[model samples]
Target: MSDGITKIKEEFDKKVAEIKALMKNPQQDTGLLSNSVDFRDKNLIYSNSDGVFTSSKDKIENYPAKGYPYKRGVKLSFSADGTTELEVEAGGGDDLYGICTDIDEFTGMATVVPITNNFTGYLTFKKNGNGVNPGDKLHFNAQGELEKNGGNDKSVNAIALSKVHKLTEELSIVLASVFGNRALKGN
Candidate 1:
């Protein structure tokens, strides 16, 4: 059964790659033009600067550089001044910046959530005030950790995704969906 699943996955990946290649080079087959139209109608694909179709439309807008493990709901951007390595932005200086979504750390790359989508990640809830839950708003600390509003933290970001529940009263790491503001334009 495992082998069957693996084979199915491999074939699916191969077909997707073929479709991507065909989309990249439309001249390969005029029939592919119609295929692209069909694909675009069904998928919410965003074009990268390089003009290549991405593997998934969900979390990644395009392929991440090697060793970057951003799955879904997170986008990456580079700090212009080089002062900050990775930044999860809540508000862009222009007020176009969205909100916090996920809490995964990649040392060499900057990450952000999409302005118009819902994202989920494992985040630590605040231990203060009986702790946080699915409907609570959150902010990211300087260290890239998520916390509730009302600290030195200025960003009053909130969760857009629903979180799973645990019966224990202790503060625990749980999966959560965060919403609002894009950290960067580039994925």
Candidate 2:
């Protein structure tokens, strides 16, 4: 079976190389016109330093009008479970640290719930006039779980175990398939 698969792959590679070589130099149609104007009238008018001419007003209107201005700002949020690390940053300012549940100055309190069994959070920054932009890091702690300092660590452990259980089942199937092929070859 391995030999057959290798032979098929070699033939496929050869065919692809042949097709690529055929497409290298395509024949051009002589009937098609080569000479054409690359610049548009609107682009030519906008490029002029002197500005656009007005017929009735007897004045030149500058490219950019006065009304347009740029506006900008920043915001951050975070979450985690079990034993997870959180990082916080204010624009041109100090970095802050805390657990998933613990609140920071930017995100006042825990409002959003965890989507998965794991914890999740986001840091969002925005320009006032435009839409929000994300910070460098957006993270979810897959191995971590929500935990109280003392009690209820067992409950968090149980949730983490459940996620591990699902992953183990998937990995087992993949390993079985890989090893099964080796066993068959040995036979």
Best candidate, TM-score: 1
Q: Which residue pairs overlap in candidate 2's backbone?
A: 81-144, 81-145, 82-145
| lDDT assessment of candidate 2 | 0.23
Compute the lDDT of residue 178 as modeled in candidate 1. 49
lDDT of 1 by residue, 1-187 (tens): 9999999999999999988865655476577454554434442433221222222444432222223322222234545566545443322323323233222345433333344544455544433424555666555444334555564425544452444344356443445554544432211
TM-scores of the candidates in the order shown = 0.34, 0.14
Estimate the lDDT of model 1: 0.43
Q: Who wins the lDDT comparison? A: 1
